[model samples]
Target chain A: MIVVGLLALILAFDVAHAGEIVALPNEEPSLVLQEPNECLQGNSYCAVRTSERRKFKWIEKSATLTMDWQTLLLRLEPGVFRLISGNLWVSPQKGQSEILTVETEAAQFSSRYEFWIRREESQILILSVRGPVEIRLRGDSQVYVLESGFQNWISRVDRRGRAQMGIPRAIDIESHIEVWARLFPGSRTEFRAALEEWRPIWLNAVGLSSEIHQELVHHRELAMAREHRSKKAQAEARASENQRLRELFRQKVLLE
Target chain B: MTRFVLFILCLTLALIEVRSYFHNYFSQSDRLRGEVGKLKERLARETLRRDLMAHQLDDFRQVVATLLPEALKPQRSNRADDYPLRNLATIVFEQKSLNLGLERAGVLFSKAKTHFQQGEYERSNRIFSSLIQNYPDTVHLAESYFLLAEGQFQAGDFEGSVRNLDAMITLFPESSLTGYGMLRLGKIFESQDRFEDAEVVYRTISKMFKDESMLVQEAQSRLKAVEL
Candidate 1:
């Protein structure tokens, strides 16, 4: 169970960073084990508060773990963030609830919203949302749902050169009804078209399906093989030519 | 019985270690979580401060634009011409609290001149035009017109250049640049093949400066070559 949880955390880290998953070199990343506690199976949640480098606090309750920590550091300013996983929901300090979801081939969780928080007095409150999961804030507490489809799926290019991938999560915003209705009429269509343009490049990079992509890979391989053979033949021909010239010179010398 | 005894002893040791580890781990994790929380707060405050500074800088630029003159006079810098004119304007841009009008005009003039040197003719022309429109009372009005003429020339708008040069010569007759302006007029007339009109301008320059400035000599040479 510990090993499985560690793997999931590593995968989550990969999604947050631009998909580089190797561990940092020459240093053992410190891992602190917490006592086993009941994990939230439904509507899992976590929150953190950071105060520029002086102190930090985290409270996490998920389908697999219930962990909380508070620590002090020299200073912390930019690039501090909070991440939570499992069928999650978020409630911001102000307007509509949100849900976030994460899906993978092995396991799937929906409505897993992540948020950052800042400390006020002794308590912390949400400041911003980072992941595509839904969020609900105060006043007009409608639940907004936004989730990423391909949060994690390690892909290796196959011999046939194709890979399947999912799309990023959608975002939900609620404004005055008139404004909202006016803005959303063609929003989905435009967004899908934009996604379609980027889909092929990403899919090929991850080794996914497409006849054109496969044909390109085949041509590249064939060209490489031909180049190798041509180079070898040129070397052999040069050797033969050199030997023949040497023999002819030897005969000419003997005749003289 | 012996195997069971050994197993019990191992279990005891494991329990002892596990309890102590969990106790220490939970305490340390709590401390770490608190630190991360504080860092987030600091980040928010710092970001807010930086954003406010940027907003203030933008506002300063707008105020400078509003107060600068319609025509800008160029100042020959004590610093070598190799230094960009815009750098001279930096002090004025940073002094927005002063509400001084002429200083801002100087900055705009410097910016226009820098743009012209960089081959951004359109931008330079617009800056010069703005100076002329905004600060007609400015002493640099005639200079602005002249600079605009130079911009038009660089952009292949010879007709526009002729109009602006004519305006500069008429508006600032007593201005120190009359000789230079007249010389430009001669060159323009020569380009149009109006050799007789060009000769009159060259003769006028010769009468104005008996010392015969280098520009007068060039104009005289061009006139003679045209006559031949």
Candidate 2:
């Protein structure tokens, strides 16, 4: 009886220990940063900054943009900024033909956000701060900017502003009665920064004078004035033509 | 010698019974313990997995904070390379499992867009026509039909534009671009000096896009033009 009791005890101990010895296969989780969603925020397209060697990925369901690293730049066209989250400031950069969309996602405390990045070439820059940024590339190699911060998102600038770039026609100051300067808010920082950076860079790289700066400003003003006058004249002409038609109709009815 | 033999037999019987009892008892306990250990390990692994996921989220947040500002800065211009449209289409198709219905419609629409951009009206028309014929149920069919109508209008094919516009309006009544389609139809009527028909479309858009400045302005302009 004692022998049997001792054996039973040993067997029970063995059973308990055996349960503790069994184990399962281990699985490690992934550590890669991937795009959060689809439907990228901002404009439909932005300039391709190929020199930056940036890769942008888009998630189709949620609009967001994810950047691989810093030195990647994207911009939005004018009148294309839709408020997604946080505070955004927009301004027209001097001597450029595009709008700048700047966003600060620092203040509002929220992890969920949407971003869209369309890769194209133009001056417009769209910036979305503090949101998941989606980057969509349709074809070809695309270049982008990855700003360093906790806030993420893509700001797009459409390519429609290409037509408004530098004038293709030769200008004759004599034929041009007035010149107006039209400043597009494409890159609020870059275009303005470029101008600020240009003088120093130009003097160092090529060389420039105060006279040249004045001349540049003068030409810009002339272009803006000319565009304004042309638009006004066209509107007036349309109105006048309408009035003429009205008078002619009145006269014909009376004569009849 | 007899006592020795009896003792041996009893010892053997005891050994067998003890072994059997131990096996039966411990076998069940061993299985139960194994299950318990498995549960414990699973709990530990899940905790680790959750922590890893949280860490990944934190890393993504850090990356976003660093990358967005850089994107807004002016970037250096890239060299122009010929974009392989065909290769891109293939890649997109492969990724989406080559949903043939969607792919063919996409091809037709792409062809139409390319032609339209290049100002090849007749070719665009042909492509859009084929799309409309093959995949009338395609989501892009509405857009294709709209493009066909626009192409016709630009090519001065007013009757053709009207026909396609009518089809777009009737077939895809729920399309978001249908408003623009309606606007185009109004413009077509205006061009033909059919003031009454133009007025109907303008008024409809005015009701649909209420408080939308651009559409409202367009409707107002068309209304004024028709009223005069």
Highest DockQ against the true fold, candidate = 2
lDDT of 2 by residue, A75-145 (tens): 33333322222122222222222222322221111112322222223222232222222222212123233
True contacts kept of 2: 0.00
Instruction: Give all candidates' CA lDDT scores.
Output: 0.47, 0.48
User: What DockQ does each prediction reach against the true complex?
Assistant: 0.01, 0.02
lDDT of 2 by residue, B1-228 (tens): 788767766875687688767775867655666677667555654653454456346435544434433333335233244234333334433535447677778777777878876879899998998888988767566667877887787788989988988887788765545666677788778778888999999898788767446556767887997999
Residue ranges of candidate 1 with Cα displaced over 4 Å: A1-256, B1-99
The alpha-carbon lDDT assigned to residue A63 of candidate 2 equals 26
Q: How would you encode candidate 1's per-residue C-alpha lDDT over A233-255 as one tens digit per residue?
A: 97897567445533432232223
Clashes of each: 67, 63
Provide the TM-score for each candidate, comma-separated: 0.27, 0.27
In CAPRI terms, where does candidate 2 land? Answer: incorrect
